[model samples]
Target: MNTETSEIQGSCHCGTVRFQVRLSEGLMTARRCDCSYCRMRGAVVVTASLRDFDLISGEEALSLYQFNTHIAKHYFCSRCGIYTHHQRRSDPHQLGINASCLNGVSPFDFEEIPVNDGVNHPSDRVSRGGSEVVGVLRFVPSNR
Candidate 1:
């Protein structure tokens, strides 16, 4: 899909953690994941290259969480307990930024978002040295 480069600023609730990220194509790639962890967190995310993400402040206020394969790194604010973003295992080159955190952006703005099948993450079935197919995300409309 074609995308336009956009720079967006964001922060955790209470502004304890601040950041700015340059998205390759704005929010055209916004989505949700269906893994158990994601289902509970219920965040809508968009991709950003690691180098494009800048933590402007509040490093001491940030906390981390990892699980399962431990490939992804989740970062949140200890002060407000808001999820800011995560280093994605599926795409090591990109991080998933919380869509709700972007300044003036709302999750309700998305008409529909794709849902990734993180529960059946391809790495589990594929050979260690080989790659597996991560099936396409389905178009799931929001009921709101």
Candidate 2:
């Protein structure tokens, strides 16, 4: 496990879901998804093992929403109604932080990241949606 040396802070629009992550260069690896919600939100995700993320204040300020297999727990600020981060269903040990939520970090650094097919994950024993394996594409180039 990589030790975190710097801290990155983030909050929802309403200032309710305040949290911090111990940042490291390794954590900057971002990935996008073509799943319905992901595409709509234009989220680039950076994963941190649960130990790296801290919910400083606002445990009660947040609400949990789950769908489909109910393996992933999407956490949103109840006050501001912002989806800040989620406990990943694919990897139970990691927390998926929305790249957009990180202050001062550009998605450009994470360009050309591989997009995983959450909509048709093979581990999904029960199909909630149609299977469509989409090829990963560079959503944004570094120069752009």
Candidate 3:
């Protein structure tokens, strides 16, 4: 995780959705989740204050998806079918921006990303003991 802070531009796959956001802890907050939804979507997300995210364009092209508790609001491009960001269920004030959507950024950029145990989310637990790091996802590039 990196602490360098900077506002960056991002867009959906087909360029139907465009947005800019200031990462709260830069890439320091980057993480993956093992929840059912996250497991299927498979996006490396970084944290950002909802107030710091700006939807520059394609408002109508954005689609929302929520399930189960419906606290976390997942958003994506309706046209390109690419996820842009989501409002975190653990903290509504924060948005989880897909690192792949950011310009000049990719999920492969991180060699080792922490994976949260979303299957046993804190909200569902009696103690509400915060997120748990179940494991790490490492990407090793081939020399060939």
- Which stretches of model 2 miss by more than 4 angstroms? 1-6, 23-27, 108-110, 125-144
lDDT of each candidate versus the true structure? 0.83, 0.70, 0.92
**Which stretch of 10 consecutive residues in model 3 shows the poorest summed lDDT?**
1-10
Q: Show pairs that collide, candidate 3.
A: none
Q: What lDDT, from 0 to 1, does candidate 2 have?
A: 0.70
After the best TM-score superposition of candidate 3, give how far the Cα of residue 86 lies from its true spot, in angstroms: 0.4
Rank the candidate models, highest TM-score first. 3, 1, 2
Comparing 1 and 2 by lDDT, which wins? 1
Clashes of each: 0, 0, 0
Candidate 3 Cα outliers beyond 4 Å, as residue runs: 1-5
Top TM-score hit: 3
Question: Cα lDDT for residue 64, model 2?
Answer: 89
After TM-score superposition, the amount by which residue 3's alpha carbon in candidate 1 deviates from its true location, in angstroms, is: 8.5
What's the TM-score of every candidate structure?
0.84, 0.74, 0.96
Error of 3 at 36 (Å): 0.2
What range of 10 consecutive residues in model 1 has the weakest lDDT sum? 129-138
